[model samples]
Target: METRLSLRYTGPAVDEGLMDVYQASANMIAFSEFMVTAVKATFGDAADAKANVAGFGKGSFITDLVFSVGGPAATIFASFTSDHLVTVLQEAFGLWKHLKGSPPTEVNQSGQSVSVTNNTGQIIQVQTDTLNLVFSEKGADSVGRFIKDALNQTGITGVEIASKGEPVAHVAQHEADYFVPVAKESPVSENVVTMALILVAPVFQDGNKWRFSDGTGTSSFSAAIEDQTFIARVNNGERFGKGDVLTVEMRIVQTRTSNKISVERVVLRVLEHREAAQQPSLV
Candidate 1:
């Protein structure tokens, strides 16, 4: 079913009926992804959701659009009223806000319902199937981070979710930080293994990952070099260019709740560094 919703922004960002195209696009994209996550988490794994903009209006800056929730479980969404979605968003944001700055001292959850007790002993509870949307995150996702960044931008004050031209949910400027997700748990596992990587790009910075890839086209990733000796050699003018092969011990860490798999590539040791065959210059 298609639910008409308007994302209206108010403040200096939309000055005189104008908003930066890039900023507007970023916010829209982030919100769309957030909605997609919310839909699946709320309805079920089989439910898919997407947003389509119909037009942009500028009383305070609004993108009038439709959220198409479809898939095998789409019927469930049809029965979900606009208020239901608004409640989900509001509660999700509220949960994040509480978790980040002033985390709950204790959380009592019974399936989809949760009761949180803060440091001040204040207890707040929310019951919704979408509670897990914000409940299970070690850190804010790139989408959530981007949305928070957009909201905190200068002149961008507030956001309101509306249906039928009436506001049903509101996110105030002061609440912008609520969208910034915080890490909740540590990685599930960390394993070290020796792997051969071909240098794709080199970083000379103090703390930045260097890009590399295996011979196969399947994977390319950036990793932090932890071999002090090898790094010292590079600092002393060791000529390692792109396509150079390096065999090193790399650390792989996996976090389940956030579904994050990261390569720290401590590069414990560089067993070998083979120079790629040089191509003749056509000068």
Candidate 2:
């Protein structure tokens, strides 16, 4: 009952004016009376329809945008069909194609499915009987807000993410599409860039390079360190391995080859290590 959209932007540079225009369009959809009325009519009184003037389906909208100069800036937006809210948002974005010359590179839709791991190595048959929705990375305007608003609108008793012992809020970046120019000058040089990210997957050595998961669910990078001392520490002893939750600072070298800025590899450096504090388990 959910629609996921992956919008790709390919151009030289995305001017601030383009972002402003897209933001204005998004706001129009957010405040559109026709869309709100349609949602309220579809869901009816017993279920959807919040006390807020916007009403029904307003809580289902979630967007994430990642834009880098000289690269494809993509935005992912997810919505639900229980109240026809997702459709309305999609239509709103579609209007851009008619108004502007180009449209989004891709649009995708997927259903909700639960994946369970059998760590015990025992055969188990699971049947579908109950349904539940869990929200993570709580924020005022993120997925957490949508769930909260949906509960209030539907009068559904649900536990807030904070109540489940998670951080109530975190920094959030608003995501939307932008028009990038095709022939702009390079903004940055080939320098080592640093980033701090959470290690989601187990750090495993893949040949000479080590694969890493930054938990972004989209892009993953590989690490190659010239320093053999650190490699010996990890390979010989259990200094830092899988299941050890810690914040890592990584050094990345971005080299522009031809027209694209290519990130050759990332060097894993442990700026801070807290082995005892395992990764937070969201209930």
Candidate 3:
């Protein structure tokens, strides 16, 4: 079974402490959603994917504030959920930390570097300095997942080439416009922001229709089957099949404020199960 998990930031009432804070919040939400989409692309189901300790479900899974105060500077807490949530989270955070510093410098090596004009009629010149692009290790995986998910969410499909063979494929590439950075500012009070995520995976048959458990009460399936398949792919590198149930979980976190509203940290939890029980076969 395959399922889709999504997150959307409705936008805050106030721009808040720093322009970056509001921006960071928006970016985080987008990034988190992107991560979920990536899991769906990789696992084909949210349930089959690994989840946080928190849990998973439908409706709005939100993290209003990880840490909040009346002031401009406050810590923020946030999280995301899906199958492979832990691994994805770890990678995302790692990348974030890695790229938190200054942007790298790039230079042109060819002689007679000349200025050129683009279709927009904007003049550009090549630099002679070495470029130093840095990516955050803290949220690397998460960010990658986010970008990956964003591409899949676009509804585009294709074949992915591999050394072993051709697998069902999808493509997601990042553009400069898609990149948003965390902002910096001092806080007025000790406010905090918190975030929570829910992963839901629906069960389905060959036709992509929802699947239900047999009346015999032996095998069971539910919304979480997708998540389970995700986790299975992460752990075993396999895809989910019919009659599987996905498990959903959540990850919550709170962090001390500094400048940005990025995820300070997160902890996960499992919520509910919609699958049936397994029974012995009748001879």
- Scored by TM-score, the top model is 1
Question: Candidate 2's error at 149, in angstroms?
Answer: 55
C-alpha local distance difference test of each model: 0.68, 0.32, 0.30
**Model 2 TM-score, 2 decimals:** 0.27
Query: Model 1, 1-283: lDDT tens per residue?
Result: 4556667778875756566778777767766666667666666667656677677777233433344555656676677665666677667666666654454577788876888775667776876554567754522464354446767777777777776777656677787776654434456778889989999998987778899997899778888888899889889988878899999998877654345444344667888999988999999
Candidate 2 yields a Cα-based lDDT of: 0.32
Q: Report the number of clashing residue pairs per model.
A: 3, 4, 88
lDDT of 2 by residue, 1-283 (tens): 2212221121222222232344333433432332333333233222223212222122122222111112121111122233234333333222221222122222222343222222233222211110010100111123223322222322232311111122222111222211111111233444454554444444446456655556568775566655455556667765655434444445555643224565665555555444535668899
Candidates in order, TM-scores: namely 0.70, 0.27, 0.19
Comparing candidate 1 with candidate 3, which one achieves the higher TM-score? 1
Q: Which ten residues in a row have the lowest lDDT in candidate 1?
A: 59-68
Ranking of all predicted structures according to TM-score, beginning with the best and ending with the worst = 1, 2, 3
| Residue 50 accuracy (lDDT) in model 3 | 29
Each candidate: RMSD to true structure?
Answer: 5.0, 21.7, 23.1
Could you give candidate 3's per-residue lDDT for residues 44-90 as a string of tens digits? 33222222212222211222211112222212111322223334433
Where model 2 places Cα greater than 4 Å from the true spot, the runs are 1-188, 200-207, 215-217, 239-249, 276-283
Q: After superposition, how far is residue 229 of candidate 2 from its true place, in Å?
A: 3.3
Runs off by more than 4 Å, candidate 3: 1-16, 20-25, 45-83, 95-283
